[model samples]
Target: MRFVPLSSRLLPGYGTLVLAITLVGIGVSITRPYLSLFGTDVVHMSAAELGLFMCVNGIGGILASTWLGRLSDLRVAKKYIMLVAAACSALGYGSFLVIHSYLPLLIVSTVLLGLGASAFPQLFAYARETASRVPDVDATFATSSLRSFFSLAWVIGPLLGSYLLQAYHFSGLFAATAFLFVAVLAIVFWRIERRPPAGILGSQPVKSFAVLQNRHVVTACVSYVAVYTASSMNGLYMPLFVTKALHGSDRMVGSVVALSAGLEIPIILGLGALSARLGKRPLLLFGSLCGALYYVGAWFAQRPWEMLALQLFCATFIAISVSIGMSYMQDFLPDAPGSATALYSNTNNLGQMLGSLLGGAIAQWAGYREVYLVCAVLAATSWLFLLRGKRFKAQEQKALRAALTSQDIETTQTRRAANGD
Candidate 1:
């Protein structure tokens, strides 16, 4: 099946998004993967303190992103908001070099890092709005392309991070992250055009609480939380499940990690192409089932090779949920791009946190295999939640039709005013 590639015509409006997201994605991948190691080895923190550090960072990210998400849809241009987010994230990452103490580090993660992380979702929000103007391109496809750039960055980010970490230590690594974010700022200032607030749909920004009142939004958020939580749990324990239970070596763990990431890049693009034809709900349900299928494979995996091959299902689940899921969430609240992305981001952050905590407990209390079983259950449950909400499409179509009618009226009014009507 042939697909429409990223056309050159779309680049002027969109090219910077690719570059900016790549830089930040690489920067994030470089430092975040090794953060726990830095905390333990550098700060000399106790186990509980380390846990506190991670928990606080996660919570801070949620609150900061959610609040900033709301503010972005208001009077100010989102590009300016994104500039601030990039600066804060840079400061937060750079601070890692100097602040070796736990309390001060906690403060930075809670504020700066939290605020900084909001930029990624804002980038998606910006993409959604911009893509809406470029009618020739499918918005979902544009978002998926951006998501692919981030995914591609992650594939290489770890190797580069390892080199930097080995050579210059955490100082060099964090310094690099800060520098990259600075590049993101330059890209935003120069490339991203200044636009008015999010009125592309001719709808005023609604209150955050009002958006959540929609049944589809709530249902989608909860369902995704389950999928993300399951994915998180699987990621946390997969290594142990291979090593401790299957008696596989670290090679298998590395193989699975690398393979899953490798497979995700293409699948993200492919499913994105299919989305315009197959519709999101079907693909979403299919992805959710993939998660369950992968976990079941992991549960029965006796050899490392068998586990390595199961990455197909794992990659499918991740691509659909991770990349396409954002667009799906936005469908529920087309007018509030910032809020829609923020709500999706919060579910992701919340799910990962829950997975880490719950996965650890399950592994300790039961076994590595049981963790997979529980996650399998969660994945299936998430699918059911989305499936039951089949009526969401009717409302979604009605909203889109209304939005189009409103836009046409506004255009005619603007033309009449220009003619001195």
Candidate 2:
């Protein structure tokens, strides 16, 4: 049960890589809440438009993530890709200052922010490659821990966004995000190392469409999409549900959101350790089941406190599902960890987009209760998928072991024949 620390003897470039990731987290957090707020307050858009804009963002992420992941594997310059992405994001955020219309905002923001999504996959690939070069480090665990820092940013980012909105409005928030991206660009240019030679850093071109052929990879991606949808459905609509259905005040809703975000940290840290010990499949199934149960719990709650309590449970379940599912995906595709991580990450973005749009529509037509009920169903469905995924992963592992064993026996026979033993 000993936890492995990332090796201290990392290449100088790794430090810049971490810094780049931190800045990206900060940049995104700065603008996260403002996107919806801008659509509502500034552009006077409806809930549906807000949902669509968010979906647009996800579409951008999906396109960028897949391409950037492949590019990272091809030993492209991480710093160069990240710097351009950060600059594009900064431009996108800056454009919001003058963009009062929906269409322009959508196109500009997606192009800018969507490209920004490229940063994380590139950084993840860099981290995995760097860790592999170090003799003592476990790259998978290091990547997991490194990714956890984004959740930590989520805890702080929303609070900062809330305060910034209160003080300076949407423009201020976007401007702040722009500044963060500029800082990211500066740091990457100044500090990041040049791309290492291919194979030296475990960087190699991914065979075309090979990741899609892997059953475990596909299962993990699908499971993640479902789990993310379930989680984001609650996040996107729970505040409105609390305010409208339960007669909760804005203060109360904010408290619920804050509590959920704050609670995720411990849940993530604990679940990370638990996933390693108990294995990923059990945690994935259990987490999804608990998530479904939490939504059902929310449906029956009449009081504000009851809803708040359910939010905490929902957050806990999501933390378990995401942390474990991501680790599971990485373990399955250890050879191309970047693709695995990118696929998992993109599923999250897609899930959020779909969940937000669907949740908003359900809340609009069927009522908030129906939204929770639908979420519960989605979560429960994920359990079935995870069960199937578990079986597939076990079979894949067994087959791999058998292959390795045969290879070893063949090597032994060849050695014996050569020595006439």
Q: Which residue pairs in candidate 2 have backbone atoms (N, alpha carbon, C) closer than 3 angstroms, thus clashing? A: none
Given candidate 1, what's the lDDT at residue 306? 87
The lowest-lDDT stretch of 10 consecutive residues in candidate 1 is 3-12
TM-score of each: 0.84, 0.83
RMSD in order of candidates: 5.9, 6.8
What does candidate 1's lDDT look like per residue over 260-327, in tens digits? 76788999888766887788888999999999999998888888888889998998898899888998
* C-alpha positional error of residue 47 in candidate 1 after TM-score superposition, expressed in Å: 5.9
The CA lDDT at 312 in model 1 is 89
Best by the lDDT measure: 1
- Candidate 1 lands at a TM-score of 0.84
